[model samples]
Target: MEKSTHEPTADEKYEVSSSLEKGTNADNGDTRFIKSPEERKLVKKINWVFMPLVIMILFVQFIDKSTLTVSALFGIYEDTGITHDEFGWLGSLFYIGYLAIQLPNQYLLQRVPISKYLGVILMIWGVTLGCHALGRNFAELAGLRFLLGFWEGCTYPAIFLLISTLYRRSEQVIWFGTMFATNAAAICIGSIIAYGIGHMDGHLNIRAWKWAMIIFGIVTFFLGFPFYLFLADKPKSRWFRLTPEEEKIVDERTRDNAVVQNREIKRDHILEALKEPRLYCFFFCSLFLNLQNGAISTFASQIINRMGFSSLTSVILNIPYGASIVLFVAIATVLSHRFQEIGIIAIISCILPLLGAILLLVLPLGPVQLLGLYLSTTSPAYTLLQTYISSNVGGYTKKIFYTSANIVAFCLGNFVGPIMMVGHTAPRYTPAMIGFIVADFLTALMFLYVRWSQNKENNRRKHLEEKGLISPPPPNRELLDLTDKEDLSYRYRL
Candidate 1:
């Protein structure tokens, strides 16, 4: 394929300058930093500082979310005196608000500058979580958790925007996968915090579980500012202590990556995004994948409790689950980079969870069986699916929509997962496993549909070109090869 030296038309260049002057509150300077090909390649490589910031924020976010699960060992469940089913509701309610905020959050990322917007969100969630220390009933706790979800929803889409803007399609899966391993770290760290605090139930005449929430909230609040100061709003807006060359490299590399197909966000383009079929199919797949994700987030602690271990040991033993997830993510990232076959990687990941659920349902209750459940449930499907979304959806508007839709699926799954842990199924958790099995099969089917549809589109393009109905396909780095652009018959991952 001919290399794209596709500079914007004069009108487009003028529009970008006009936007910079009006939006950034600065006189127009040399704002648009283009680069030579060598500089562009160097910059396109990852920025070390930003990658760590992304990992840190993601780690903190996951720890805060998963810490509640670890709290089960400290008598939080008993203090609340909620039924098994109600416990599920308490767990799932966060996502109800989480889903509600997805679209608004994505919109804000596009409109409000990221530094102010994302930093404010982090502080809001941190303070709201601290309010949990005062919760006296299920209703009060639920409200705080919901608000936390609402404020925290901004982070996911924003992170997606940052990474999608920084890294190219091939580099994303590794960083995304590594960032995802924070889920495992969160689980391990949450358990460690809970284990230490679980002993303080009578020390301060307060419940250990309440202490768990209080401690984590304070830490998250403190970490927010440093993270905010360090995060790059976008490659073009980066203002850290980097040398001029580093800045130039980042700007050039990020632009060449298919990610920045359009810099100007418009209302008409936003509406046009809603029409892509890939957006919808990916939504369903994400929903099912996240259902399992949400279920595990809510109940993995309880599942471990059945393994004849103390809450502390249950928490500690569960470290392997997260560790396994880290391993799976790393493996998947390598495969995606080497083979570029998102479909096969996704299929294998989904199957692991399906097998894990089956083992939980049929095998005798024992350590081995329980280990299987943990291994299967914690597979890397969720992050890999997200990689597929980021890699394929190139249009800025469509990326926003897809990102929001994925979070919505996450919310739905989180909402449904806990509810399935019926009161009758407590300890046995038979019903929850059954729900997981069904969700896994549906997720697999969606991936299959995504693969088949993309292949069909590719064939159609080939046929049309053979008949001289359309231009011949270029060598693989064309927009068609990148597969992220709209209007290219690039099928969305179901």
Candidate 2:
């Protein structure tokens, strides 16, 4: 049989109608839709499927990555013949491998099935984490750490992409916050696990720290199969069963997100993204914010140890640090959702850390200094930054590029963070604290600039609409897959 040459009809080419949908208001002609009871139920179902999987995957990744710090307390350094300075290199090298592969990973994400890609990487890294148990020196452990970082590099971007593809822009902040908050929770869980494992000293002739790596690694390895089976790449994936109406709702939601679902890379989209000033702004903000994270996450236990606490006591002290992180993340996300103003909420988040930095710099090593350290868990602000990028950026390729650039900056900050705390600095790493304070202040300023730029664009569009210079956008404009700069009708949320 000869192949038929069939062209798509206009209706088929654009599945959405030009008229506003049922939930949206036609009078104001806004694209925003209030969810109906049916839509709410559908969202709930999606949450049930996605939330636990993401939380578990991310939690394990955090726990596995954090094992280095816990192990440091449990005598991985002494047992493995590694010095404190060499240990910093281990932390920094992970990000080096993480940074190196991101551009290629972005391309792979564009071409591959996301769930399968993530699944394979998860399993590889799981084995890599377990290998840490066998390393007896710096070179051996550092090599495994690099491989672990390289494999784990794609995990966060994949999760961010999944959340963006699944949820509306307005709903993304809460979900992002929820997933990232796992990092804080992981600190406590890791500490408790380490404390338990510490009691296993001399069992089976293996060290407690080594056993920590082995146990978490095995658990992570087994998780990969189930994750691959359960995660849906998009709403249309075989993992989900949707009625016709529900499928239509998913399509409508995609349109409302103002991002392309198409996988094809567009050169114009990349060029446009390169020209965007906001892209660079977000990049620097990510870099500076994570510098603090690099320092704190790797050295929190050691700092407590320096304050005259025993190894076990130091591990327990991190519980308060973890609690503070959960509190800050919860508050920031809720306030951002309530006010619909991430910029301001991000500023508040930064301010707390800035105060924490000041306290750390001035106060002596005691309960007060510890209080400052706990207050410095501004990592939640990083979650807000991720939400900002996913919700504001448009076009598939541009979004990918934006996220890749942000990750590069994130890796750079993490790579440099540990290096700032020299061994001689010890408990009073005054210079590092100073760097934290400065970075936090600059991040706040960057958020302000983003908010200002968005307001300027919104006002210009409003004026043009009033003067009849530009017509309101068609309801199907989002289906066109235009970049944010190309889509004049798209107003950025603060």
Candidate 3:
């Protein structure tokens, strides 16, 4: 909200931009003046070309994550001779692998071509998933699970940070929403696909679970090719075939988005991120929001079966559960983006899970309680939180560090959740629900504070500017590669 004394010069623009990507080359397209109409067409082309492939990659990723959850009902437990306790540990192991990779990923994402890296990883990831079929014991399966998590961990943040480079802050809301919505579709459709695969259990003498893993793995392996071949690596990538004018538009966008593409690690940015309250808030919000998600995803079939539904019936019921999440994500993202009341929307979304948690505690183990279980897993808060950090965080190093921390928080919540659902509790995880209630409440308060803190800063900056104590920020101040803390003219998006 504060202003800078100077508008950005060409040198400063390059300083900030050098971090995001190499600018358009002369031979590729005419990198000159662009009209508004041409810019719209380019963006629309990007939406069509980019978003669907992203959805496919993400869809496969989500389905792969839930493979363990679905395999449980298809004879994996008995086939592997694993007990319930070991099953829970497998969940944690995956996240442990995920958490381990975050720091390394921060560096790799900047240095490597993210699309190609992710592609090869998915191809490898699919092979890892299929290998689950060969596990005859807990140790083998555990190792496989860890590897799966390790590869999968490289995805979400990479996609998110890439989006920051591709679109303006305003354009990102819908894309982020679309990306989160993929999980719901994956769950709904994957469950149906799993049910169909269950019938294949005896055909090849390969149990239904093994077939499920192998089949999905093959599909995932092939999906990587498109990414390697077609996904744009930078604003000026030849893949997009932007006219020179459109490339110019992207340059303008680069300044506005303020995301640096440079690979250099800045110590000051890291220190600034460590000192900021938003970093912790992003971490804790994701951690708490995902706690219930981890538990439910791991145990959905068992919980529904205990409610007296058959395993097939339990899988079928997930259709509705997944469908509901799509709605929740849609409503939350649309409303928050439309009204610019993201914090309030986030606070409200958190309340759904809290109420759902309360219902799980008070209601008996049956259909009603099952409804509570579904309610307890609201999906919108996570999306909003992710968007907030992606839109607001500046500086390549700081954003990488910040995004890695958020992923780490996500891993921690998920890692602890399954273990917390102790076998002694059996059907109803009363204690876990109580813990979830607390986490959800804290999530709400954190969002509220983030909004208030940012708004207060906005007001402080506004007052100073009005008094002429500070000049207006340079039109392209973001091009300086400044962290949010270092940028005096920066305003936090609500």
Per-residue lDDT of candidate 3, residues 1-494 (tens digit):
97778988655654443343333212111122223565678888887777778899899998988888878889998998998878988988899988878888888998999888988988999999999989999999999999999999999889888888888776677778888889988989999999898788888689998998899999999998988888876776777788656666677777667786887888898888888898899899999988888888888777777788888888888888888788889998899767655678889999888988798778887877777867766578888888888778878788888888999999999999898889988767779988999999999999989988887776676667568877665766655788766665556777
Question: Which regions of candidate 1 deviate over 4 angstroms?
Answer: 1-46, 240-252, 261-272, 462-494
Candidate No. with top lDDT: 2
Poorest stretch of ten by lDDT in candidate 2: 21-30
- In angstroms, the error of model 3 at 433 is 0.4
lDDT of all the models against the reference? 0.68, 0.83, 0.82
Judged by TM-score, which candidate is best? 2
Clashing pairs in 2: none
TM-score, per-candidate, Cα-based: 0.83, 0.93, 0.91
Give RMSD to native, each candidate. Answer: 8.8, 6.1, 7.7
Which regions of candidate 2 fall more than 4 Å away from where they truly are? Answer: 1-32, 474-476
**Per-residue lDDT for 45-72 in model 1, tens only?**
4456576667777777887777567766
lDDT of 2 by residue, 1-494 (tens): 99889986645533433234454222222356567565677788888877788898899998988888878888788898998888888888889989878988988888888878888888988999998999999999999989988988988888888888889888999999998788889988878888899888779999988999899999999889978778878866665677666677777778767775677889998898888888888999899988888888888888888777898889989888887898889999999887677788888788888898898888977766787888877677888998889888888888888888989999999988888887888777889889989999999999989878887887787678779987666777757888777877766878
- What TM-score does structure 2 among the candidates reach? 0.93
After TM-score superposition, the amount by which residue 350's alpha carbon in candidate 3 deviates from its true location, in angstroms, is 0.3
